[model samples]
Target: MKKGTRTSRLTVFVVTVVAIFAMIGIFAQDVAKNTTLGLDLQGGFEIVYQISPLQEGKDLPAMSAVAESVSKRINVLGVSEPQILIEGNDRIRVQLAGVKDQEEARRVISSTANLTFRDVNDNLLSDASIIKEGGASLGYENGAPVVSLKIADQAKFAEITQKVSEMGTGNNIMIVWLDYEDGDSYVKEAAVAQAGGEAKYISAAQVKSAISGDCVISGGFTESEARELAELINSGSLPVKMTEIYSNVVSADYGIGAFNKTATAGIVGVALVMVFMLVVYRFAGVIADVMLALYIFAVFAIYGGMGGVFTLPGIAALVLGVGMTVDANIITFERIKDELYAGRSVQNAVKEGQSTSFATIFDAQFTTLLAALIMYIFGTGAVKGFATMLMVTVFCTMVLNVYVSRFLVNQIVKSGALDNKKTWFGVKQSNIPDVAKRQEQFYFGPFKKVDFVGKAKYFITTSLIILAAAVVMICVNGFGGKGALNLGIDFSSGTKITVTSNETLNTNEVRSDFEALGYKPSRVQASGDKVVYVTLNQALEQDQLTSIKETLTAKYGIEPNDNVVTPVVGRELVKNAIALSLLAWVAMLIYITIRFKWDYAVSCIVALVHDVAIVLAIFAIFRMEINIELISVILAIIGYSINNSIVVFDRVRESVVESRKPKLTNADYKQIVNDSLDKTLVRSVFSSITTLLPIIALLLMGSGAIVTFNFAMFIGLIAGTFSSIFIAPQMWYTIRTHVKPKEKKKKKVKKEKLDELTIPGIND
Candidate 1:
């Protein structure tokens, strides 16, 4: 390379790095500000509705229509980017992230009816059952839009109105549910409002007269609103009854805690990883950190572009994403070091290392991508948010690691500044051998040789013991024993209320408060002494709900947030979680089988199961509340565990290809596994360290729910790294040993005898 050319290339590299960071600094805040924050990050509430036909077998409208209806309902709330998802066939999950007052939001969401007249206590007096078909229409009354109804039974209407009038002046109005169904009550609607925006309530002011032919009801409705109500009644378009099966409300103070703590944790965690890279890999580590900045910027930018919600789990994903992206760089740089150890020139090592390791990085990233896809498909609420962020992170990491990172590294290498430096690439001086004198098939790796394959039995036995221990703990604590896992309201049928007060709350005081209300809380936990979480054994009735709300509001001056999960929704969540896990497992298994072989796939699955079992065992022992977040954690571990297995198997396959082996013997397989482990052992360790750092930050700094999640993730990282080294490859070796290859068949030769012809026309 000419000196001038080297100078020019180095200049361009320096200029590019500065420009990338400059752009990142300028646009990062803009992107973050644009990105939406989830209810878990900002104050809001989330509800999952289980919809059914107002009348059984009546053929409810399509989920799309219901969603559209729900959208129309939320549009009135003035919430920006509210998330409404239609889940499965009969469920809709609505998330109002920035809803200031959920009272109106709730009221607008679940108020559905079929023109029923009820009292304040929601006792039904009359319904549209007596109204003649097409009796309802839009009309103007006193310069306001009103709904006109022509009654079939004027006598019945007069009697109902007279009864409503008798309730006295202040409470004389009948609670009306226009175009609503009979299954729900206004009291329940007022408290629950499980689905809102459809039901219209009219305060008749006073039923001054009994003689009424066309009853015109007005409550300051818009013409469009009155017209839709009248049209719905005339068309008899019955609104689908929505049952609030599950709801999670995060208080503003609660969300602020998560936001502040997690933001601090993520920043500190990712910074430590960057510093670790620089310290260990020297100058190359700086390059990795530079690219990592770009990677983070890209994730936020892409997610912001796609209108992805930012959540605590999403921040966790980004922090973990930094580790995984760093893993790619470690793979590439380590490959170059290995090549340099084998006496290749720095430029040759750079090109060869990238060329060989590209596929492995893709394989690792692809498997995790598969899990993210499945999670996005089958997950709800926080899991879905995590999956969304994960998918974006996956995309950014893949593109940056494959294209940008490599381009930057190659440019520097071609500039010839790092020509003969060993330590510059994180390789020791003694690692490279004398080219003329040394004559080994492969150079000894950086680490001393360890026969990981020979210890397969011990590793498997250890994992089995862990699994057995987990099972025992679960059984002893579960069902008939101690009630098994600490099931959250998400996986159990109950209500969880969060109350915030200006003074620090005593758990015993909170317990007594609930007890005074004719209920004893199953559990009472306090956060920062000001916020308290109370779990009840069952969902409260409307009156009970009202009493609790009034009581808490009077005492605390802030309404208590409640989460109610029905048994049916709980069972469905468990079922869907199991199905989602199995589906992800099967999908990854199929991919591995197509990529490698069945034995490798089996080993990978076993390792994944082992990792999950360990996590479950730890959680059970620790009594962590098992919730929907567990499903997300398990699926993520599956993706991550399989990725580790794939990387190991990739290296083994690479070694065999280099050997040009037609078939592998037991000894050959053992040698391959051990050699591959020896080569990747350092990379795996470094990868684990980088990955573990962010999660360690999570466990140290995150709040309750996230602490639990990150602890599980931390366990998974350790298990994944350990299994990739000791268990997975060892399992592969053992499987290969037991399953012998079929011997090739030998062919027999045939002899030919020559015959002579005497003449052209005669034969002998």
Candidate 2:
């Protein structure tokens, strides 16, 4: 390289590093401050409601109208940045974060403010029909608190008042009721001069003449009650019934503690990964570390830019992304090292390594991206947040980790800094073979003699046995009255209470207490010394939940975290989860077919299914609680497993193309497959290990909330690695070798036929 050229390359490397860090510094605080936090990370309650039509056989109310009503009601609670999303066709999810009065908030949201006015005979005169929107207010009438209403239609109100005035002297009374149900009636207010029994209503008033515009309903109500009534009146009535199907309330202290613990674990885990990379590959590792940092910053910047709400699972995704991003770097650096081992110069090695690694990197990252899309489409709440972060990380890994890392490494190599020295790039001088002596059979590292193809039958048989056992166990469980799997409250309609005490509480004692209260808990387990988890098969009402909390607080000296889900919502979630998984499978198959061959695609998808099945089987055998988080983990495993398969398949494709064979015999196919596996075995193992490290850290040291999630991923990582190395390639080889190739025809018959027909006129 020329002196000026080398200097410019060195300058480019330095500038890129400085620019990335500087941009991170500029946006870090703003991103942190602007990014939203989900209810789990922040303090608040989330409720999923199933909206039903009030009248039988009537069409369900418009979802938009229901959402608007809910939004208005939430606004009255004074919740800042409340989220109300319409889920599915007839469900709405309301999240109120950082609200002080959770119980009151729930009551207000579920209340059906159906205001109605009836005559002395209990005949309905008018309802919210004549009331103007946002026209209700609290006012005083004769030193008593009253709710004032403005009529939207003067003629309607006048007609109602005229009917009331025409009644007999003692019967000319108009009765007002809020949310009047069967067997409910208007009662007279003790403070007002009225003649009627006491009931839950605003007031009963006598009309002397027809009223036109404004009306006042005064009752013996406190200032707070009067204000609430006015607010409800202003918000109007919900058109449909809102059944609380799912709800969760997390305390602020718990959230803050979890955040701190996970954040610390993440920092430690990432630091360890960086140090390990640097130790393994010197200068190349340094470049990778820089790219990893940039990848994280970019993910955060994009997350904040998109107004994504950060959650606990999201944080896990970010930490995992840091570890997974290094895989791309590892793959590229390993390829470059292989080139150096083949006796290529540093410049040529860098160029050829990047070119060769691009397809593998693209295929792996694209499969993961497909999985994320499926997750986003089917996931909800924290699961959805996790999906979002995963997608962003995959995107950044492709762009920042792959291309940018390649650029930085090439700059360093081209600057003549790594010239003549293979050690800096993690290749030893003694290991480099003669350029002319390089052979296809040469392995990159250790385990070159391992026969992956010969052991295919053993691996396949073992996997099938395990799969068959899992199926039997699931069937037995399904018929034995428990379930096919231990479904959590998120899947089964139920209430889950997590209690923390100042002192260690016995699981038996907690179970006994719940049973004594006429509730048989399906499961009771202790988490550490202070926490106890209780699951009931039936959803709890608000009053029941309050009672349980009070009881637990009085006995255990700690308030409990509570969750509820209805059967309707649970079934919907399960249905969507299955659909999402199938969709992802089909999408990945299409992608693999387009990028590689159909045989390879089929084998990869089969491996993916094998991984998913094994993970689920493990869950069933262990009876782990299968929840929404587990669903996310399963999809992640599919993405992760296909990534490994693609890497291996990419290598195989390259080897096949490089062979320059007109027709591949079975022996040739076996050699190619085995050679590709051997060459890439080290990379695959290293990548899996690097990815598994952080997840293992999370499972061992992170918060209890994500322990199940981490465990699922951990099992999945192992299963994915196994399938990719053993099953996927073997399946592809078996399918490829079964096909017969067409033979070429010979041309010698034409000469003999011409000799025999020489006497014809055409011969002359």
Candidate 3:
């Protein structure tokens, strides 16, 4: 079990990887058993009911009482984990996690069982069921719209009818109750006469006086009934009469086609990166790629083990992560190449490569991690998912690039693999010659100092104005009706439709027709030119769905090839997204502060906040619609931005640690920070360029509202890079001088001048 032994270590590592994969398989089964399938993955039904607000001038307590009463009715259905909660105003959102049959789910949700009792003259009497199902119009009986009630089986309808007849005066008093199973709303009403006499059973009207005029129907309520009722009431009340806002039966054909294309894209991206590595670095790159493959195995094992849902955005994150994983190897392998080219012996080059690239790897990884942490902390829904994926990949890549790669190279060197006349990996042995024994002099490039105080007022003032306006706009819009930012159906409540025609059709034609029908669709795409997923806002009722489908059939000559679809957003899901985002940020702040110091933490937070605020401001300024995709884009940009700051900070920290012999002045340290920024500029610009391409493609070629999200990301990417270089470091200086001004001391002249040199390429 010696930690450094080669054979033993490799065996353990291999075994560990195998065990994790094994566990993942087992966990997959478990997840299949308990994991709730999202509407997209498994054909299911989701019905959202908006609980109506209280009547104008109603007391808060009364509203609470009503909500509670509604909740009780939903619980009676016995559906486990029914998501029910109050939304903005009087709206409540109810989510039934899984229901296979869409039609059946809809029937249960929209049927309002407003059981009531009425006398011959049709005088209304107390019944909560009637209130719950108030929208229904009872068919005419004896020239009056008379509501009928389904007498409970236990009540003995015949016996009750007889008893009420004997008790007397019934000129047609009818009892009404809603039957939840079939959309069969009005059952026949039984006549009722007297109150005191026990008639075995009486019309709901005759029994209205008892049970304190408020009754809870305990028996005959099915599991689905409770669930539906809960959703109806939890969501308060329907807005606009609960019309089908949107619906689409996902064509299995389109789903499968998209899956194939996505899978192909992923494979291609990975293959190209792998090929690049092999051609560029030869033996070391081969080793890196092999380890890179292993890294993929390990990362996926983690994803599966964590029950990470494979989604479109998730796929994007994975692919992006795959590309980024190569970044470290590129940096390391390039360093090794540089070492060999600079005339270092194989052993010396190997050793130097590890030591020299340590800072770069550490700096890059740490910065990226910092950004991921922020996104995971502050992002909502899909943003969180994307951030989590990025974070996991970052961690795994660090191991593969630094530790695993280092060990492999070390083993090859120790075994005299590169001692041949020609380098073991086809490199020339004569090319390896010792240059410097000391590790102190390895430099990425020349360094320069930069400061912001000279233009501090302009930057600060403009930033504040932008930030303030964003705040004001957000307050006015209130996230497009919610306190939080508006999310697309990807994270917000919504339905999705994937359609495939018998023949090929233009995607724009399909999208135009859908838009004309008022579906506000986004992410519309054609696969094989015949199938498409036209994402739409969540529809709450069957009518809304029918309306959408009718339009598609009438206009596009395409029927939903599968079943009709509706999706409901649960309160818990939204809560979790918000909570997780907040938690991630707080956790990151604490961790960073503890590892570094509170001062760094404060500066990082300021910059991060500034970055986020500016992003929000831009969104507001453009009047761009922000959705879950947009949120994810913002988070991604934030991650990139924070990495920029972290690189500068890491350099400052290293300089501080190295200068312990004779402490450098603040000015001298600033110069060190400036140099670090300059040194890493190429990497930053390159990485940013690489990252921006896909997003830019998405913006240019992607459908509908996805462009809004992409645009937000585009702005954020530029802003994040800027803030990291200008905002964070400058803020750090400002805070240090103002908050701890007394700590300032006179600096050495030369050191001070060196520190004051301007950072290259940064705008004044």
Candidate 4:
């Protein structure tokens, strides 16, 4: 290589790396700040409304209309990116992230907002029907805020005023009610309205003369109150009733604290991964680390640009993404090491390694990306956020981890920096074999000759024993006997509140407080020095919930994270999660079948199920709460875990094709499986470690719901690695060498018997 050419390539590599870092550094904060956060990450609330028909026997109200109503009402609250989604045929889920006033949001979203004009006797003269759609406006009346209305029917307003005026004395009063339900009268609600109870009636006046065309309702209201009244009126009334079937509210304090802690943990985890690469691969490791950084930034940038809701699970995904991202670089580096061990030149080895690793890396990443898309499509709330982050990570891995890392390393290889010392790629000088007499049976990896297939029986037995023990434990009060999986409010339909105080809290006191309000908690546990979690068996009504939250805040100096799930919503959530899990398995099975074969696909599915089952079993044994996030976590583990089996199977396929003979024996197939695993085992371990480092960080240092996410991820990673190594490939081997031959023998017997039947002389 010419000195000038090497200098140019090196310069290009440096500039590219610097530019990426510089750009990210300059704009990262702004993007992060501007990026939309989910209710779990930012302090806000999500409410799922179940709508019923306005009148009995009528068809259910249009979900779209209710969503529209919610959208208009929340829009008036000036909340950004309020997710108002119409779910199924009769539900609307409104997510208001970064919203401060939860009570107001709930009221506005569900209120009927029926404007009516009536007398003291409650005789309705006019209602919202006579008011123009956009007629309600906020204005000032004698320095007090008032709502002005443009009456569509002049004679109707004039008639109401004249009737009220002729009624005489204390009986001649006109009343304006926002939501006038039957049996509500001026006399009955007048004292309540004066004492500042519910703001059902906006304003009332004793009419001395008839007026028409335009009128103003003055209630000595503050500007905010007047503005809310105008917005409610202008948003138009919806006849349908919106019942809050589910809700998740996180206080701003908890959200911000979680964000900071999780982010710090992620940083520590990623830093550890980068350091691991640097120590293992040296200069090549540096390149991998650089690319990993770039991949991280690219994922965040894409997610932020796409207007994704960054959530607690999203943070966990990002951390796991770092670990997953490292696998891309690890594969190539290990492959390069293999080429070096085969006595290839530095440049040639770099080329061969990248070429060999690309297909495997692409296959692994594509499978994960496919699963994430399914997750995104099927998931809601935090799970959706996690899916988005995972997709971004896999996508960025495809680009940066594969292409960019390869390019950067190629730049170094082409620059001739490591030309004289090929060991810089991590292979030892004495390890490179002589090319002139290369052994035909040479195993090309760093793993020892362990005879993985020879121990298949032991591995399978161990797996069965552990699984059986888990089942037995569950039947004996682990999960199946006592309470299965410790299902969170998301599945059980109740209220779970996490109250953070300025000082230490007594669990007994927390229980007493709830008991004081007539809500006996199912459980009260202290989560931290200043935080206590209270679980109620019943989901509270909206008003009752507001009162409880207000009381808690007043006493604790923090608004608790309140989660409420109704039976209807909980059932639906559980149903959807199960269906999505099955769908993911089916999709993965079909995909693997197309990519590999039926045996490998089936084995992969078995491994996936095993990984999921292990996580559930462990969580059940430990009595950890399983929330909605588990759905995404399990899917992510399956999607990511199968890549291990896929990688090994990919190697196995190559070995099978290369070792094909006229008559191959079972021992030959066994040797093939063993040899393939040996070749890929080193990479598998490295990949898993690199991926798990971040999750371990999250598990140890993270806070709130994220710890649960990371804990599950951490266990899933181990189970996935174990299954890929022990169970999946062994199952495939058996199906191939044992099962297929029996079917062949059976077919042969049937064919011979048919031949004997067809030729009667042969049978005699």
Angstrom error of the Cα, residue 174, model 1: value is: 12
Candidate of highest lDDT: 2
Model 4: which ten-residue window has the lowest total lDDT? 747-756
At residue 666, what lDDT does model 2 achieve? 86
**Mind sharing the TM-score for model 1?**
0.83
Clashing pairs in 4: none
- What shift in Å separates residue 14 of candidate 1 from its native position after superposition? 1.8
The residue-by-residue lDDT of candidate 3 on 1-764, one tens digit each, is 12356465566545655564576566655544543332333333333344432244543444354445545544444444444444444444444433334555444444443433433433443344333332322233444333322323323444333443444454433443332122222222221123333222222444322121222323233444443443443333311122232233333333444444555555665666667567656876677667666666666667657756554466566666665676676656554654555555566667866786677567556656765776666553345567778888888988876787677667656544463322534345444443333222233343343344355467778888887887777677784674344444544555656565667878788788777776677456564466566655544355666677677666556545322223443344455545544554565577567666666667777777777778778877555544456556555654556666665676555555555345445676456656656655554554455445555554544432234555676677677666766677777666665565332233333331111222335411
Q: Taking the tens digit of each residue's C-alpha lDDT, what string does model 1 give over 1-764?
A: 78899998899889889999899888878987897888887789998888888778798799998888787677656688988998888889999987876766775677553577777666777877768887878899878999888889888888888887888776676777565444655655554433654343553346655746757777678997787666556544337888877777777776877798898888888999999999889878988998888998898888889988888778888888888899989988888888877777678878889998888899899899999999898787777888888888778888887788887887888998887575798877776754445433256685447778777678778877877777777888775656778888777788988888878788888899999989989889876667788999797654576688789889987767778888887887888888988998899889998887788888898888888888888887777777777888898898876777888899976766565456667888888898898888888989989999999998887765576679889999999988898888877777778875342332233332111212323421
TM-score, candidate 4, is 0.91
Error of 4 at 342 (Å): 1.2
Candidate 2, residue 206: Cα displacement in angstroms equals 4.1
Order of the predicted models by TM-score, top scorer first: 4, 2, 1, 3
Candidate scoring better on lDDT of 1 and 2? 2
Better of 2 and 4 by lDDT: 2
Give the TM-scores of the predictions, in the order they appear: 0.83, 0.90, 0.58, 0.91
User: Against the true structure, candidate 2 has what lDDT?
Assistant: 0.82
Q: Write the per-residue lDDT of candidate 2 for residues 243-282, one digit (tens) a residue.
A: 8878998766566666777777777778878887888888
Total backbone collisions for each predicted model: 14, 0, 33, 0
Pitting candidate 2 against candidate 3, the one with the higher lDDT is 2
